[model samples]
Target chain A: MPNILVVEDSPTMRQLISFAMKRIPNSHVIEATDGVDALKKMSSEKVDLILADINMPVMDGLKLVSLVRGNPTYKEIPIIIITTEGAEEDRKRALSIGANSYLPKPIQTQELIRLVNSYLTKQ
Target chain B: MEKETGYLNKADEFLQMFKKGEEFTKELLKENEKLRYKIAQLEESMERSGDEARTKLYEDRIKLLEDEINSLMERFKQVEEENKDFASKYIEVEEENNNLANLYVASYQLHSTLDFSEVLRIVLEIVINLIGAEKFAILLMDDKTNELVPVASEGMAVSAAPRVKFGQGTIGIVAKEGASYFSDNLSYMKEFNPTTPIVCIPLKIKEHVIGVISIYSLLTQKSGFTNMDYELFNLLAGHAATAIFSSRLYTQSERKLTTIQSFLDILKEKPRR
Candidate 1:
């Protein structure tokens, strides 16, 4: 079972993601409100993958990426940035900051599941 | 001969006296010439002093004028800078006002369309595009069950069959309160497993709460919700409710008219028979 950390600010969005992730077999989804909360969780638990939103309060997704990458303990964790903005610049920024992948918002469930499965299986 | 000698002596005396007198007059004339020359030099010096004083006064006046001109120029520059700043700010405010006006007009036109579903779809699209929400859903109140049922949705997959109970979930809470509600993280909510930030706004028609509009990130979780997002969602909900209400009224009237016409036709045919 892959342990996944889902960080988002919206309650509806969080529910939707969690609901979609729960469809996948043998996956445990943990939730965080923002980067700060995500970081706190990361420090306490071992997460195989991280699904983060780009825009957030307290700390943003991009900053979370840098924090995760900088920590040797969590450096190898696969991180995906999901955002409403589909611009190339945002994708590039996320990638440059050590994000494993980027997904745009309003994501289809199948696509998200496939991506998470591929990453989990590959690791 | 003695008389002639005496006359000559007298003549000599007169000539000597005359010569002496002439010498004295010449000296007097020389002294007068020197005095006149000194007087002329003194007059020249006075004139020169007067001219120098006049030139100094003119220079002082010019300096004062120059200083005044410089100060005025600096003041003018300051005023110009202030004006430029004010003009730019005014333009920004005007542009914002124009955008708001355009949004209002667009919303009005969208509401005027006869199809309720289309109007709701358009409103959702507009709200999503404006606020950049990842997924959005519109749940209307079921008159019979009094539950919030998902009528239209975008960016998420909602079960069309399951009607969430009023005051059970975030959407229901919003409907129950007849107000807008926001949760940055659903995981914190006891009713819902925290997954992402959510914004839910109630749609009211003539003070009667009818439905709710909710939006959130489907794939990833946002860090937190913003006040601006809440305000924008509230505004969108208000407009959507009005449009929905109007469409419903139009449909009701249309159906009533058709029913009345059919009834009248039947009565007319019977009377003719």
Candidate 2:
């Protein structure tokens, strides 16, 4: 089964994303309040894919991406940055730091699902 | 005696010649048999070579068929991928259509009631779900006091919401001009400040302004407004104003009827002579 880690500060947004992820066939979703919480969860459970928000309370998503890419242990895991920031610079910076993809909110449910599926099914 | 000796020598020579001719005929028959055996061996080898060539042709045809099958399988996989993409896009479009239908239903439900509190509640619900607002207030204009007072609020205390006079602050200016005010930098607003609302939409019935809807802060995930948000705001500006007005009028009419009934009961009672 694919494990999806959702990192978001807002409870509403977290619930929304988690609900959407559950629609994926045989996907298990893990909720994280922030980047620190996401890292803690990653240490315990095997994370197959990560969908994270950019602006978070403790540690931001960009910092988390850089840390994940720098570490040899978890460098290969695909990370998709979902953010309210739709600027081109934000997308470029996230991809440069090893984010697999960048998706802007007001998220389309089907689009989000399709993007995850692509990453999860990739060899 | 000389004649008889000559005849005997001639007969001996003729017998010798006849014996040599018989030897030559036997050698010729043996050579012809060897040549016939060689021709039979050559014919058998030629037939064997023809069978080998036919086997090689069948092998090449089988290899070509297998290659064609492999290429066909690759094409089938490619077409399946394309179909999946189209299916996903179709689902996305359907989802968007559902959202639009929901908005229309909500708008239709707005005018379905004349209860004052219910209308306000509906407006609040619309803003929360559609606009993604975390903190906001709906302020109505007090006719006698001529100040905007909070009738309903979310994520904040209604009593704490400010009462603004005409042309006093941002909210007041918006009410006076009958135009909506949206902050340029909504992402920077972390806390609720009445003076600088993230957005202030003036509720108007026709050309006359009635009240205002001020959003101090938005949901954390909602960093900025979308086109849908603006469209909803425009909708609330007119529909919300009319709903509130109609409900209030109904309430006042009910109150007047109660007062008149009480007066009629008092008059019907005959005074003690």
Candidate 3:
């Protein structure tokens, strides 16, 4: 069983992402409000992958990426940055910081499903 | 931080401010390539494996990957609300700048002239242009009737002639008390049955209120007045009162001088006789 964590602050967006994720047969998804919440969830169990937003209160996704990459225990876990914005600088910093992938906001359903499916199949 | 998206409607060009985090596109693309490389290694391992145990391990990893995809699909739902909050906070700062600018202009133009007509014109300008009053009337205190009467007006309904008594309506209430009365929503107040909202600001000098500035409605949003609107009203209260008073005094003095000179002319007529 693979555990994936979803980090975002908006209730509406979280539901949207969850609705799209149902296309994936039978994987368990963890919902986190921010980086701190995601890290807390990670400490208790195995999170195979992470899907996070860039801008969040308490802890943003960028800082989370740096911390997760630094941690020996969770370093290899694929981290995906899901953001409402995807500027060039944002992409470079996120990738350089060790995020495995990124996705822009208002994500299309099929595209989201396809991308996640591709990453999963490859791993 | 200010919490409202109302200001975003005013500046559509700046909507991109929220999208400043766009760098994820290029970075994610590069990351995908790296993932593909890793995938090739995984495929190679699976292809090279001959032992049943090694084959089982590859299958296990592939199965795990399939499950992980489901969870990764659901990401960042409530985060946009936070972005909206940030945008609203920025807009609040912008609104403050606008308030200060309007205050400065209204104060400066109020005392810019001593002529009565010019003084009246500036009052109308401040009311209409700076304060964004939709329909307004400037009423000065009449010495004989001890009444407040309209000197100049714009956008007032012809049928809704303002004949407010000393203690009647919002206009009269402000005049009697010499205090400003503002309401964004008039219908909600107890016993406040006005046809439309009208902010009544008493124009004052020291303790004396010389007149009332009646704002019939706001041009932008008539629902209510912001703190900045009240600040403008405060400026008008003191500055406008003094300006109108001075202009009236100047006109009165000029008339007095003319009467004095004509009397002197009558007295000097003996020389011609």
At residue B120, what lDDT does model 1 achieve? Answer: 72
DockQ class, candidate 3: incorrect
Model 1 C-alpha lDDT per residue in residues B123-210, reported as the tens digit of each score: 6655554355556677788879878887876665766324678887666777888877766464543333222226677888757888
What is candidate 1's CA lDDT for residue B180?
Answer: 78
Report the number of the highest-TM-score candidate.
Answer: 1
| Stretches > 4 Å off in candidate 3 | A1-123, B1-98, B157-160, B184-197, B220-223
lDDT of 1 at B60: 99
Across residues A28-72, which tens digit of lDDT does each residue of candidate 2 receive? 999999999999999999999999988888999999999999988
Instruction: Give the Å error, residue A71, model 2.
Output: 45
lDDT of 3 by residue, A2-118 (tens): 677888775434544655565478777888999999999999988877888888899999999999999999998888787744466778889999988876543434556677777
Please give the clash total of every predicted structure, in order: 17, 0, 18
Location of the lowest summed lDDT over 10 successive residues in candidate 1 chain B: B188-197
Candidates 1 and 2 compared: the better one by DockQ is: 2
Candidate 2 matches the true fold with a TM-score of: 0.51
DockQ of 1: 0.03
Best lDDT among the predictions, by candidate number: 2
lDDT of model number 1: 0.75
Better of 2 and 3 by lDDT: 2
**Docking quality class, candidate 1:** incorrect
Interface RMSD of 2: 6.9
Per-residue alpha-carbon lDDT of candidate 1 for residues A23-123, written as tens digits (9 for 90 to 100): 67888899999999999998888899999998889999999999999999999999988778687888998999999999886454456777988999899
